[model samples]
Target chain A: MNNSKQGMTLIVKTVTRVTVWLIVLYGIYLILHGHLTPGGGFGGGVILALAFLNIMLAYGREATQKWLNLKFLEDIEAVSATLFLFMGLLGIALGGRFLINFLPKGSPHALLSAGNIPILNILIGVKVAMSLFLVVWVLAGLHEEKGGQS
Target chain B: MILPYYIAIPLLSAFLISLIAGKKDEWAVLLSTTAGASMLILSIYSLIAQNGETFVYKMGFWSLPIGIVLVQDGLTCLMLVLVSLISFTSLIYSVQYIRHMDRNWKYYALFMLLITGMNGVIITGDLFNLFVFMEIALFSAFALVAYGGHAEEYEAAFKYAVMGALSSALVLIGIAILYSATSTLTLAKIAEKVPTLDPGLIFWTGGLFLAGLGLKAAIMPFHAWLPDAHSSAPAPISSMLSGVLIKVLGIYTIIRLYFNVFNAPDFYMQVFLVLGAVSIILGGLLSIVQWDMKRLLAYSSISQVGYILVGLGIGTRLGILGAVFHLFSHAIFKSLLFYNAGAVEMALGTRDMRKMGSLARVLPITSATSLVGTLAISGIPPFNGFISKLIIIIALIKAGAPVYAILAVIGSILTLGAMMKMQRYGFRGETEIKKISEKIGWRMNTAMILLAVLCLLTGLMLLPGIRESIVDPVVKVLVDHSQYMQLVLGR
Candidate 1:
């Protein structure tokens, strides 16, 4: 877990880094396949969490916080919620129904199969990612506060 | 057509509140209050004239069997009114309740978000939409509960968040299973296709769905998070949480699934009847021993919800009628009680009954209003609770469930006992100001009094004509669950 290990320990660290990258990539792969396959925003988001977790575990909370500022994550979460709401509202304006699939229904088994489904997946991924990310950070911060209290 | 706005106003307000978080505190209050008030008015208007017209807004104008939709019917109208009314009252109460809190913008922002979620759940026609709205509402609620960040509050919020996350995950999995089976997401479409589903899928998914929604509803086994979250939140939020959140999230969702989607099967009713009975008796028994005032009210909500579930579960016209009536009555009076609790907590600086006495002398409006609310909820004669309780008991006997009737009567007495205890310890006894907490503003007093007046008057809505005009449509929606599809998507 330290930064200065060498030889076999360095090999172990390299393997861990590669494994974390694989997990993160796999999550995105699942998310992209959401509309046509069984995976979705939730699955992809969890995978992303694993990737982030690896980063934190490898470096430390401070390194992670530097790149993932709490304010930015909070904004992303809010914006994602707003985006989903707007997407639902857009269907209303389009004259079909609330949340109707107005986009071209790509071939059922194709990559872009369900109109809005892909959009929904992307939004869900971002929303879930930001939500989970911020929630984790907030929880960690709370722990620090609690530790201080005692 | 107008179904979307049930969620829109609160959501828009939340966005606006956040955008203007630091600019002007007064503007944030005005904006959220206006959003809440507008929703309140719209819901009441919908309640009165919402019959015979089913509004369906298909997402993106997509054809049937494929698109997500928002369905607004009589039942939706009832819940919409209940949610907005309670939300409005709570927002009003919070204007003064949360003055001491530093982050006013974040508080109102979350409040708006919670309202949006609750409102959306009542109106959405898509199963997936239901889950989405459920997450939005519960997530914001978790944040609000932790707003105070006191050790106890944080502990409760964390517990609540963990349990809430589990339920949401279950619900998402259930929706995925449902989607896999039906290949469609609209609620009416699901209702149409669900009956023909394979029995294994029906049983398993149904159980999953039930467990998921049941946890949200806090019925018996899934109720572990209720006491802590309910007791630890700010008083206005405590009012909203106990008064309306559980009903919208748990009871309403369960009823919608049972009646519209699942056809009110015997097993579901049986489950509801038993849960209702147990919650009523158990919650009542637990409340009697609680010395903390808001905690007592929190427990009382579980018992009250039991009454609603039992009434709705009876499946008779009288049963449905009694259930919806009790729902409206509870939303009003319970909120009134919370406002009273908030007022006392403000003036007396304590939620423990042992620390308060003869409070009526100093806080006349709060005491008088609380007295009215206590009488109403305890089923005293001429109050709203009595009428609904009577309807439920009569319906129970008519449905050949005589034992439940007896138990309900006993529950009523227990409720009466608890309220009497609140009355004696909280207001009627010698005024004991062991410690001064803080000064309460006029805005707080006005909100409590307004709700108390409504409690006293809403009972008159039980008159036959008023019942015919107001309650019948909502009852009919529950009774005629199978026709919801036809109504929403005309044949």
Candidate 2:
């Protein structure tokens, strides 16, 4: 209990929250601009998870549950993974081969370029985002349950 | 054509099961087991059909050197069959084994995910894609290993996660470097580009991939996280992790990358030879000191992997054949042994070998299966392990590596010693028998017996027709490295 005395100040909290939100928004921006720039789904998704992690740590698990529930996270993961697979399979069925860049290529170096690459990036971004969150949550839960029986 | 199904079936079932598994928890075992059986059959069929042929399922007809592809060659099919076989048995065993556990849906879901990752890793024709699949497998595995959430499991999972992530980062860097060098991600395309690339980049990328994947495989120098992770997981998971996960994630990918993607170097072979020798000796010596049954098995996996590396490192055709055979044999026997350990723990409520014994009097089936596993792993005559070990030793001697050959023999003896200790403490020691409430179920026994039977039959893989049908094509893929690129790219 004595350790609680070194808690964050209001200004610090507000600034931290703002920074975290910005980081999250920037991750989304990067993901959206994946096919255009160097950053793609993996980079953006990892940043998004960092934002989620910040939120989770700032608010307790119980408080966070109201907004970012485990079930919802799991659903997001499953759905996104399925969507990615479906997109790949669609390419296959269309005689393009699996994960082929079948969709029309937008202008190169544009936000919409690389045909289905951007869409794939988004799908992968969702999958990675949720997956990282789930992994962190699971790890955090494990840490909390340190005293329990195996 | 068969390449897609390897990834598709597992991916499909993982989703399907996750969707319905919550309500159908009781039947999840059956469903997963059925999937495992069908995948096993499919893998075998793929192997038989694709002998001497490389079947590539292009992601979107995006053309070679660009798009992702699922390529099935003889070796990939062999690894697939081994993975599927072990998965089927573990799924059956898990039915009874996980009866008292909570979160059954999550367990089955993660199990399905793990299988998908493994299947994807085996069939993937791209290097970066291999790393992705490896992550999928490792991520699910970390959660599964810590599924119990007990102190020891958590500690073990944390350690495993850190090590796994480090290895993954290294792998990602390796992929980046390889891409930078070759300007291609596809294995076939990279193989085509290897000679055209700068030698300096090849040297660096090769070292990165080796360090990264060697850690995953739990080869000697990089094998810190394995024992804790393998020993802490639930019994069936322990079985899967030791039996197939390390082989697929670490060993198979390393071989595929080395022989197919990059040209095998004399120095690389020499490095593997040295590491293999150390792992063989160290793993065996360490296992001899462990008191925990599963921990000992985990260490034994290191030793067995050492033997496999030795076989491959020898680089002779016989050496490669031996390594491939050992991979298959080790998967069967190790999984069977783990299943036996699980049964013992289930019945006795403890895994410490020091606790009670002469359990053979009570658990005849487990005792018998374990004996078969122990003997097979110890390289006793007439078993699958003997054939592979013999081939590896002969290959070592033939390759003018007598020192390694001698070390391999010592490793075999050490394995025998450790198994003997296991038998003495777990089976031969007398223990008080309380009235057993529940009968040792059929699912458990069936799984162990099936694996035991495979351990017995795997020796026949050396037979001429069998070798030609099953083993030779796999060996051919590794030996005829240049042909692999042509076959896959159809250039």
Candidate 3:
């Protein structure tokens, strides 16, 4: 089960350690700038998941599991989803429409201009990122249950 | 005003359970049940309060041309109420049933997702939206069917998923074609532009839709997946799959598109009639030979669905009346019977009829409730099925198709014989039963009892005054689908 936490060779591990943060930064940019650009929550989230997945490849699943539990990912994933729904419900609770842009429209093509959209995008990005990571982690068979049925 | 809550509460609670219902199964049970209960109330209230009024909710404050829409008509409202009521009962039943699998939270989460998908399908006002919601429903259904983690369950779920994917692809192609023809995704907008388009476009798109959606409904020809998929799922899920899933995905969408979107083309109506007759006989005959209790019920579901199709095929108001009413009655009674089947399987640890006998003495609640379901399904004199079937037969004769009327009668006889087979060998046989576990919990019995009582009570929906208030608007909405286009667009 690779309990000693060994991963790839020195070159690959060094490359991943160096490049992973840039990918994370790029994913965050996509999520935050989703309202102004094409890369919204979904695209950005995939990139983030890929970054973590790269870390898993370089550092080994056992090391990743030590730092990042799937249970935490599941909880955060669900929290992000619930937060997204609450934002929609927030629209309804305000006595306006169900999912109206109730916030102030700052301006066009700006970072904070699209009232509720950027926030919703951020929530979706968080959810997508965590959900994707959890799926890949489980499918990778790193979290095998004890004597579980197939 | 409350239209959004139909989808909102379930979607919210599904995630909330995963977030907050941590570790303890009881918390998951409590949270989801509250969500399901509120949903049921909202649906029933919608049926009464909407009162033949149509409501539309636009997402994100965008107009209909640009934003997605959620529409609540009489038909949609009726289905919303039906789906919610059935799901609520099933959730109650699953509280104990899922404990055996040791994964209550996951099951409840998936179940809530299922309800969300169904509610979304019933409420959405766009073609692409239906496809998206349909996928949501099917995905969860696939997972739930395989929740038992057994080899057979996985095989059945895989088969169902493949068929589901194929049907969805056809539906997507039709939607893409429609978008190309009309350059819009809203159903009413497509209807507005359909008459101005070329006839060949309509023909191809309509054919694709029928083939795709027909597979979902398990009509006579495309019903290869129903028996396995419906029979293999856990009991409550089986009830939901057999009871509401087929109707909403298959029959409901077909009715929506064929009648409202396409303007009830005479050609499709004839096709529905012939196919409906064929399904009745085919499903009936096949059901008689099965010994697996759920499998027999599953086959019988295809036949029961056939009755709804035949009713709709008649195209008269009386025919539509019977069709819609049959849909309601069939949903209740069929789910009731599935619950009984599930209860038997739970208690006996087997689904084979040969191994079960004299269960009426042991599982008395299930036996009693199953009697109501059987009579209601078999179209006995006093139950809801008899009234709906009689209405359909009378409409068939009035439509100058006496041959179809006789075929309906024969289908009835076949249904009776098939159900009788189950009753005789399954619960009333000479094989003495022993060693029943305390598997049937109060919640399970409560769910069965609720649906069984409704099986008999739903016949009152046939009474003249109540019919006008409850059933007539749904028929009017379906029969005159052009009115649907006008109403949605006009609003």
Candidate 4:
């Protein structure tokens, strides 16, 4: 019955509010530059998921729920996966083998240099991010339910 | 081009099922059934079209050795057919079976994903790719086994997950060791390099692979989790686990790696023979004591798998033939038996044999189909099991392993006694009047009946024409190791 006790203390919340956006921006950068940089979709996706987790940690379940709907997250995960598979099938449809890089490759280090690699990285990043978010949401929901009961 | 569809169709369907089904059970059923049926048709077409030749599909147009390639040969085609057939039947059965269960969409989604993983495992030509596909199939199976949310289901699933994770770790380590030794991840390249590897490293890598895959296949010493997991899972899943999953992920991988990639020495074959013999005796003896119908069938799977291993271990062309034939026959009859068990459970609401009896009067289709399955599995004459068992015994004699030949015969007798006991206790007594309905769903009945008919008819596959077209090429793939490398690597 103590509404004030929902999230962390004020100092942690303040720090988290400032840092989460920065972390998310970095994750997007990593995914966008995945082909040229060391970090790819999986690594960047985990970071993005962590950014969302930081919000949940600092702002409590209610705020996090409002910001990121679980159903929407699941939809994103499914759509991204289908998109990735479709991209692979595109090669087959285009008179090549499955998962073949069908697009023309530009020069290295350019924004759209690696053809399908960047597109695949973005799709995988979104899928992995949503999948991890869903997992954390479920586990946290279970913890909340158990806490309320006890 | 067609080879990739085996993996693509299942993967696409899994995502589509999840995306569209949301909370609708009917959509889930329709989507999954369509996926399963299409996969079955595709596999059959590929089997007929490819004949005995090997076809390799390079992913992303990357040439052989560097990019991931999907290889379709006689063995792969046979496995693809078996996986799709069993998956299709199980999906049909699940339409009615899981209707009442919550989150049926998730079940269908995981089932599709599991098929994707199995198909991928059957076709991939890369060592690391095999590990990835194995994990996909395994993770899905772990979830499916625990779908019921019962305490027993959770416990069994946890044990299965732990064992599966350990085995996967070992497999990864083996792959790492092999890669470090050979400097390549392609299976064909590894096979070419295996000849010059350090003896100690080869011994270590081979031991790791055998133990890891042995655990997956539930070979005797490493089979502790199978009974609990298989018995606790839903019946359709139990059928998948027993009929095709173990064969694809465990035995198929072992045969491919040992005979082709590693060219394992004679001592390893002896090890396989001994392990097979022990599992035969132990799995059979254990099944005879189980009162739970599903558990009895689960234990029997171990025993049947033992027969396949022993046949393969004999290391002759005929022996491999017998093993491949037995694998095919076991897939048919075992899934048939499991589906029958599921139907019985659906009608009677109890898996305990002692609780009800003489249901043959009410459940005529289930009883008749299960009778056929039981007869085939127990190696009665004119049934498929008998032909495969006979070939294996003959092969053992030809290979000059009379002691193993005798052990195999003894295993057959044990299997017969156990199955007969099951029939007597589960189906032959006075009918019990229960609150549950006696009429099972037509979909379940259709799946069981089709499998039962397949069980009876599969014996003709031993005829020279059928054998040469289907089973012989698989046998040759294993017996002649050089052919695998040559086919994949183009000499």
Each candidate's number of clashing pairs is: 12, 12, 0, 1
Docking class of 1: acceptable
lDDT by residue (B222-254, candidate 2, tens digit) is 999999999999989999999999999999988
Instruction: List candidate 4 segments past 4 Å from native.
Output: A1-4, A144-150, B431-435
Write model 1 residue lDDT over B1-491, tens digit each, in one string: 56677777788778767655674478789999999989988888977886546777665666567666777777788788778878887888788778766556778989988998988888888788888888989999998888777888989999999999998888788889988988888888888887798877766777887788888877777888898898889988988888888888888888888888878878778888998999899989888888889888888888898999899889999999899889889988988898888788778767889878987667788889999999999998787888889999999999999999999999998998988899999888776554446666777877788888887778888777777767777778889888887777777
DockQ (C-alpha based) per candidate is: 0.29, 0.37, 0.65, 0.61
Better of 2 and 4 by lDDT: 4
Give the runs in model 3 whose Cα sits over 4 Å from its true position: A1-5, A142-150
Return the TM-score for candidate 2, rounded to 2 decimals: 0.87
lDDT tens digits by residue: candidate 3, A73-101: 88889988988888888998874678777
Candidate 3 chain A minimal-lDDT segment of 10 residues: A141-150
Candidate that would win on lDDT: 3
- Each candidate: chain B TM-score: 0.96, 0.97, 0.98, 0.98
Q: What are the models' TM-scores?
A: 0.84, 0.87, 0.97, 0.97
Model 4, B250-284: lDDT tens digits are 99999999998878578788988999989888999
Candidate 2 Cα RMSD (Å): 4.4
Highest DockQ, which number? 3
Worst 10 residues of 3 chain B by lDDT: B431-440
Evaluate residue B185 in candidate 4 and report its C-alpha lDDT on the 0 to 100 scale.
Answer: 93
lDDT of 3 at B61: 69
lDDT (C-alpha, whole model) for all candidates? 0.81, 0.85, 0.89, 0.88
Off by over 4 Å in 2: A1-73, A90-96, A99-150, B196-200, B432-439
Q: How high is the lDDT of residue B161 in model 1?
A: 95
Give the C-alpha miss distance for residue A141 in model 3, angstroms.
Answer: 1.7
